[model samples]
Target: MTLDRSRWQPRTTTFIVLMAAANALLYHAPLFSFAADHLEVGSFSGILTLVTALVALFSSTALLLSLLALVSHRLLKPICMVLAITSSIAVYFVATYQVVLDRTMMGNVQNTNLAESLELFHPKLLVYLALLGLLPAGLLAGVRVEKSPRLRVAAMAASVLVLTVTWGWMASGTWGWIDKNAKRLGGLVMPWSYVMNTVRSAAPKLWQSDVQILLPEAAFTDDEKSVVLLVIGESARAQNFSLYGYERPTNPQLEKAGAEALQSTMASSTYTTASVRCILSHVDSSSEFSTRYEPLPSYLQRHGVDVIWRSKNTGEPPIQVQTYETARELARDCPGPERDYDEVVLTGLEERIRSSSSQKILVVLHQAGSHGPSYSTKYPIHFEVFRQVCESVELGTCSEEELYNAYDNTILYTDQILSRTIDVLKRIPAASPLLIYISDHGESLGEYGLYLHGAPWMIAPDVQKAVPFIVWMSEEFTERRNVHPAQLQAQTAHSQRDIFHTILGALSIQSEVYEEEYDIFNESFSNR
Candidate 1:
C-alpha cells in the first residue's frame, strides 16, 4: 500500500488544530470556576487541566483514527471533512453534556422518559448544529496545509495557554466555574467540602452572627386542635412537575389527588443545604440562615407547640444551621430508625400517630424525594414500574437510559409516599389539622446540556427554585381552622416565603417577632 503523504498531511493538520482549539475552549469555558477555585491555576490545577486537554485530544484523535481506518485514501478528502464536522458536533454535544446534562445526572432528574430526555438536547443541539454548518465548513475549505507538525505544536501551546489563563481568571473571581465544572472538579476530590462551601458561599450573609429570628404570631387558640406537618422534598424542581405544567405527567398524582398545591415559578436555589436552611428558618432565600439567628424551632418552642423535626435527607448533624438540635430532641424516636430508607421514617411516624396523641404537633419530614446519582436508592424494590431500571451506584458507569429509569422511578416512588402521607393526614381521627409539603430546593435533570442541580443562582434555571407545595386539610379542620378554600387556591400561586408565618398563624402562637409582611397567610406577604 502506497502511503499518501499528501492526504495524511491535510487530515493530521486539521485534526491537530481543530482538536486543540476545541479542547482549549471547552476546558477553559467559564463553567469550570469550581474546579479552578480549589485547584486554582497552580501546579496541580495546571497539571489537571493539561491532563484534561490531553484526554480531549486523544479522544478526538482516536475518532479521527477510526475514520481513517473505516474509509479509503481515495475518499480521504471527504472522509476527513465528514470526520471534522462530526468531531465539532461531538465536541459541542460533549461539552454541552459535561456542562449541563452531566451535572444534572449527578444531582437529580430522578425520573425521565425518551421524550423527557429529548428535551435536554435543545440548546446544545442547536448550538452544535450551527457549529457543524459553519465552523467545520470554513475549516475544511482552508485545507491543503503541509505543515502538520507546526500546527500540532501551535495547538498544544494554545491549549496550555488557555488552561493557564482560565486558572488565573477563576482564582481572581473574574469568572465563575461552579456553575459548569462543580461536579467534575468539586465532586472528584473535595466532594462534600466543595458542595458545602459553594452552598455556604452562595449566601455570604448567613455567615454573620447578627441575623434576626422572625416568628409569626400563632392564630390558633389554646383550645383549638392544631397540627402542622412540613414535608420537605429533595431536588424537586417545579418546572418538570405536572403540578407546574411541564407538559408531561411527571406529577400526575399530585394533580389528581385534590390536594391544594402551590406551584411557585420564580423560586431559585440549587442545593438542599442552602435552600432548606432558608425555608425552614425565618430567613429569606436571598439570605443565609446562620447560627446567630434563632430558627423556626426556637420560636415554635417558645410558643409552647411541640416542635419535632423528623429528618432523612439532611446529614446527621444538619449543615449550615445549629437549630436542628432543638427539634432533634423532640424527634429522637420520631423518624422510626437509623435506616437510610425513607419509608422507615414514614412508617415510624405512622406508628407515632397511632401510639400517642400530642395536642399540638409540628412534624417535619425531611424527604429523600429525589436525591441523586443512584435514584433507585431513594425508593424500594416495589416502585420499579418504569421499563428501564438502573440499580447501580457507580454514577459514571450507568447508561443514560438506566439513569433516567432509576431517577423517574424515585419520583414515582416519591409520589406513592406523598399519597400515603395524604391518606394518613386524612385519616388523622378527624382531629389533626393540616399537612403541607414543600421542597427545600429543586433539581436540574439534563437541561441545556447541563445535568445536575446546585449551579449558581445566576445560572440555575427555574427547575431548582420552582418547588412543589401540597397542602391537605380535613374538612372539619379546614372549617374550624378558618382556612377559606378560595384563599388556599390563591396562595397556591404564591412563594414559599409564606410558609414560616403561615405555620405560625395556623398554630396560633403569639410572638412579637412575627412579621405579617413575611407571613404566608398575610396578604401583604406576597408583595415581596
Candidate 2:
C-alpha cells in the first residue's frame, strides 16, 4: 500500500507531464503520421531536425502550460482545471472525427446561436465530455498544491525569458522557414489548435460591423415575370454526385428531373461562408475578397428584385435583407422538427412564392447538405439507401465504406430536396421560374487522412474545390432568358463567380455592377 502510494506520486507537475504525454500520444496520431511521412532522416545529423519538427506535436503545449502553471499558485488550479476540460473535449473530437480545428470551423462554432449549437449535443458526446473533461477536471479539484506566489511568478518570468532567448537563437538563421511553418505546427498541436482557434475565430467577428451595405433603389428592365431560386448546398462534393459520373446513384432524382449537370464547375473557396459570399459578390475568382463583405443580396433587393435568404447552415446569415428565415423560425410556422433537413426551407416557401406578385423574385435556400460528421442525421430514414452508415460523430470508429455510405445518403437526400424544390417552382404559372442549385464547397471523406472541408484555398484539394452546379429551368423560362441549353452544357469550365452576373443577365436587369465577362449566359443572350 505504501509502495503503491509512493509510486502513484503526489506532485502536480508530475501529473501534468504524464497527462500531456498521454494526450499527445493518444489524441495526436495524425501529427506523428505527418512528421513520420514528411521527415527525411538520412543520417544522425537529421535526427535533431526531425525531433525539432515534431516538438510542437509533443512538447510545445506541455512546456507553455507548465510555465503558465508557475504564474500563480492561486490561479494554477483553475487554469489547469479549465485546460483539462477543454483539452479532453478538443482531443476527443479531433481524434475521433479526424478533423483539423482551423479558423473557419472555429468561426462557425462561435457564430452559431445556442439553439443551433445544441444540435451538436447527444448522449455519446455527453459521455465523452464526462470521461475526458469532467472526470479529469474532477480529479484536479480534489488535489491540493502549495506554492509561494512571489517566487513562482519570478520563476515563470525566468522560464519565459529563457525560452524566448533560446527559441530566437536557435530559429534566427532559419527564422523565415520557422515563421512559414509555425501556422501548420500550431494546427497540429492537440487541444491548443482548437482552443486558440476558437478564440482567434471569435476575435474577428466581435469587432466586425453587422451593418451591411444598404442600396437605395433597384429597377427591373421590363415587366417580365421571373422568379429565380438560387439554392446553396453545403459540403457536397462533385466527385460523390452520380450526376458528375460517380458509379453510385447518388443523384438519381436530379438526373431524372433533367437538371443541367454543369461540367468542370468549381467553388471559389473550400468553405461555406467564404464560398457563398464569393459566389454572391460581383468580384471574380481572380480577385480577393473577405467573407464579411456583403453585396449580392443587397444589390438584387435594391435593383427591385424581391430577395429572400433562407438557411439551416450555421454561421450563414442574411446579406442586408430583412426577409430571412432560419430553420427554427420556419419550424414554428412550417410544422416539423426545429431543424429537420434542407426540406424545411421549402416549407411555407410555396406560399411566399404565390403571394409575391413582383416582376422579378430571388429566393436563396441554403441547405445543410452532407455537412459532417453527422451525415446520417441530415437525411430522413427513407433516404438511407446506402446502409451501414457511420452515425456517430466520432467517425474514426467507422470504416471508410460506412463514412461514404452516410455521406452518399445525404447527397441522395439533397437530390430529393432539390427535385421537390423544382416541383414547387413549377406551380408558378405567370413567372418564368428557374432553380439554380450549386454547392458552396466540397468535403473530404478520409481522403489522404483528411476529413471534412475548409483546407486553405491556396493548398486545398480538388475534392474541396470541385462543386456541383445544376440548372433546372422550365421551357418557358429557358426561352425567356434566351438560354441555349446545348451551349450552356457544351461550355467546359465554370466557377461560382459567374453566379452574380448570370442572374442579372438572365433577368435582363441591367446594372453597371454586372460584368458580362463573368456572366455564363451573356453570350447566349443576343438581346443584351
Candidate 3:
C-alpha cells in the first residue's frame, strides 16, 4: 500500500477535489441524513434528482477550492486548514443542537457574547476538532501540491459548467422539492453553509449606514407619571407556557396574577437580532430599509422620556439611552442567591422608578430566559420543579422527558421573573406602571427532530415562531390609558410589531409615526 514519498504529489486540481470530497463526506452527515429522511427515494426522478443534487454539492465545493488554489498553490493548504477547523466546529454545533448554518444563524454566532459562547463547550467538541479538524489539517499541511495553476483554473471552469448543466437538467423534476427545502439544504451543505452565509450576513454592513433615521417628533398629551417595563424574554415559547394552554403549570404565577396572554401572536423572526429589532423598531425592521430608523428606546429617549436598559442577554439593536446596565454591573448591587439569574435585572428596580423625577420612563429588561441547551443552568436549583432534567449541553443524549423537563424548568423560572416584575411595578403605584413581556423568539424542544432555535422563519416550526406575549397593566395605568386587560386578551393577530406602537399608545405619546392598527391598546381609547 505504501508509495514512494517523492512521487506521491498530486496535481493542484486533484488535491482540491480530494479535499472537497473529504469535507463533503466528513462534515455533511446532517445534509445526507436530512435528504434521506425527506427525499422520495422510491421514484426514479427522485433518485436522479438526489444524485444530481449530491453531485452539484460536491462539484460546487471542489470548484470553490479549485478557484482558491488557482489564486496560488501556497494559499490552498492554509485556506483548507482554516476551513477544516471551522467546518469541524460548525458540524459539531449543527449535529448536536440541530441548528442550521444560515445568514441569521451566522449573525447570531458573530453577536454571541463570550459568556454565552463558553456555555457551548463540551468534551465531544474536542473530539470532533481533533478527529475531523486537526487530523485533516495536519494531512493538508503535509501534502505536496504540484504547481499547476492552468489545470486548477480549467478544472474549476469545467466543474462550474458541468454543475450548471446538471442542475438545470434536474430543475424541472426537482425544483418543487428543492424550493420547498431550500433553506434546510442550503444551511446543511458543508463549508459552503457557514462560509457563504458568514459573507451574506456581513455583506450588508459594508454598505448600510450606521446613522439611524430619526422618528417623527412626539409629544405627551398629559404630564402623567407613567412607567413601562418592556421585558424582552429569551427563547420563551408560548407552547411551553400554561397561560397559552400548554397543560403545564409553568406559568402558575402569571396565571394567578391575571397576566393577559395575547392570542395568535407571532415573532417577527426566528432569531434574536431580527425579532428584537422588530420589537423595538417603530416599523417592522425585518425589512432591510426599515432597520435604518431609530429603535423604540432611542426614539422615546429623544422625546424626553427617561429610558433605562438593563440586559442579562445581548443581541438588541443599537440603544441610545441615559442608563444602560449589563448583568455583571447590576450583580454588584444585587444581593441574593438569585442574583446570578435573570432576577438580577429587577434588582432595585422599584427604588430606581421611585427616585425618578421624569414624567415618563421606559425600563427595558433583557432577560436570559430559557436559552438552551444548558437550560437547566439558566434557572436556580429551586426552580427545577420538573424532575429528571437534562443537565447535558448535548441535547440528543438526553431522553425526551429529561430534555422537556429541563426546558420547562427554564419556562417555570421565567414565570417567576415576570410575576416578580409585575410585583415590582405594582409597588410603584404612583408611577402608573405597565408591564409588557414578549419573547425575542421561541425555542424548539426536540420538535420535528430539531432542538434549540434560530431556524429560518419560513421553515421554522410553530414552536419557534409562536412566542408568548404577556401584558399586565396596573390599575392606575388601565384607568389612565383606557386600556383594559379584557380588551387586550380579546385582541388577536398580534405580533412583536405591535410592541412599538402599543407602548406609545399606553403612555399617551402622540407621534405622527404611530399607527393605530398596530397598537393593541388603541381600540380601547375613546378617541381612537
Candidate 4:
C-alpha cells in the first residue's frame, strides 16, 4: 500500500518534537539528578557517573538502532519507541531501588507507600507525567502517517529530531546532576551506596553523648558473678507469630516455654543495619547516629566484657568498634550451609558459651529471620511445619493463605531454632546467668498494602517496628542479676536505647559511659 502523504502536518511534527523533548527532560532529572541529591551523593559527578555510563551505553544503542530504522521504514518507529520506553523504565527502577536500600538499611523492611516515595522527589513528577503523555502521541503520529510514504518520511524525520534533542537533554542533565552531587556520592559505589543509604536513612534515634551509665564505684567484686546473653534476630518483624498475637501459631515452641514475651506497638526503622545499629548502640530517639562516623562496636569493646557479632546476612558487615579487640573476641560468622537455615547460627553458640574464658560475654546471634519473597529459605527443611506456602513470587497472583502460610512457616522454623537454643542454654552447666532475645526489627505481612517491612519511618507504624523482647534468665541470673519482676517488666517499656546499658549492667561491668538516663536496669524503672 502507498504511504499516505496527507497526514504529515506541521501540527503532527510539533507534537512529536514536544513529546520527545518533554519525556527526555522529565525522566532524567529524577532518575539521575534527584537520586544523587536524595542519597546525599553530592552532584553530577557523584550520582551521574554510573548513570552516565549506563545511559551512554543505552544511548549508543538507541542511536545505532535509530540509524538502522532511519534507513528502513519498517524498523524506525518500533525501535525508537522500544529504546525510549525501556530506558525510561530502567531509570525509574534504579532510583526506586536506591530508596528501597535507604530504608532497608535503616531496619525498615516494609514497602514505602507510592505517594510518600513520590513526594521525596516531587520535582521529578513532571517528567513522569510528560513521558506518559508522549507514549500515546507518538503512537498516534506513527499511525496517521502509515499509508502515505511522504507523510511517513516526514513523521519519521520529526520523531528522530525529537529523539536527538530529548536524548541530549537527558544525557546532559545526568552529567550535571552527577557533578553537583560528586562530594556526597564520593567513595560510594553502586549497591553499596544504595545499601548504606537505606541503613543511614532508617536510623531510629540516637542518645546524646551526655547520657551516662551510673555505676556504683568499685563495682567489680569477685563475689558477684553474672552472665547475660543477647540473641539478636535479623529482619524479624513482631507481627507474624502467636507469641506476638499473630493469628497463626508460628511460635508454638516459644509459647510452650512460658517465656515472658512482650510485643512493642510501633513501627521502627526498616532494615537490619539501622535497626541493629540503633539497638546495639546507646542511641536514643532524639538523636540520629551519624553512621558516616562513630562505629558502635568499638564503644562496647572499650568497656570490660567480651563483645561478639555473629552475622548471617551478607549485606554490610557490622560497623567495627575496635578492629584489634573485636578480632580477638568476636564470634566467627557462619552464615549456614546455604543462605537458608536459622540452625547454622546456633552451631558455635553453645561452645562459645561453655568455653568462654571471660566471666561476662555478650553474644549476638543474627538470624535470617522471616526475610520474605523467599520465606521458605529461612528455615530448616526438616521442619516443613507449614504446607501450601507460597513457593514462588508471582506476587498478588499467589493466594493470601499461601503467602501467609509461607511466612508463618519461616516463623515455625524460627521457633525450632529458639527451642533448640533454649535446650542448649539449659544444658550449659548453670554457669551462664541470663539469656535475652530481641529482634532487630519487625516485619509487615500484607498490612495496609505493605507486603515487606522496609516502609518509610514517617509512615510505618508500631506493628512493623514493635519487636519481641524475651528474657530467658537462669536460676543463677535470678539470684544474682535479677531485679524485681515488676521493675523488669516496666523496663520492657524502655526504648531499645537501653539495650547497650542493660547488657553491661546485667554483667555488672562498670563503665563511665553507661547512662542511667537510658539504662533499662537504672533505678528509674523501679520507680525508686
- Indicate which candidate wins on lDDT: 3
For 402-494, candidate 3 gives per-residue lDDT tens digits of 999999999999899989989888888678888899998898878898888898877789999999998887788777767777777667678
Write candidate 4's Cα lDDT for 142-221 as tens digits: 55323234455455665655765676576775566556655333212232334345456443334324333322332443
Better model by TM-score: candidate 2 vs candidate 4: 2
Taken over the whole model, the C-alpha lDDT of each candidate is 0.55, 0.73, 0.85, 0.54
**TM-score of each prediction:** 0.58, 0.82, 0.94, 0.59
Where's the lowest-lDDT run of ten residues in candidate 2? 1-10
TM-score of 1: 0.58
- Candidate 1 lDDT over 1-528, as tens digits, reads 854445534545455456445543533343344344445567764555545534444444434433443343344345545544544544443344443323333233333334324434545455665665456656555555443344454455456456655655555442243335444543322112223444554444455545454444444356565667788777766655556555546655765676676645345356665466566555565653343356666566555556666665552212222223223343454454324455544655555654544566676778767766457767767677665765543344556677677777776766777777777766666455577877777765555435556665666667666777767766776666556656656653556566776787667665665566655545555543
Question: Between candidates 2 and 4, which one is better according to lDDT?
Answer: 2
Ranking by lDDT: 3, 2, 1, 4
For model 3, the superposed segments whose C-alpha errors exceed 4 Å read 1-7, 40-47, 149-152, 163-176, 524-528
Q: Which window of 10 residues has the lowest lDDT sum in candidate 4? A: 322-331
The best candidate by TM-score is 3
Per-candidate clashes, comma-separated: 26, 2, 0, 60
Return the lDDT, model 4, position 151: 56
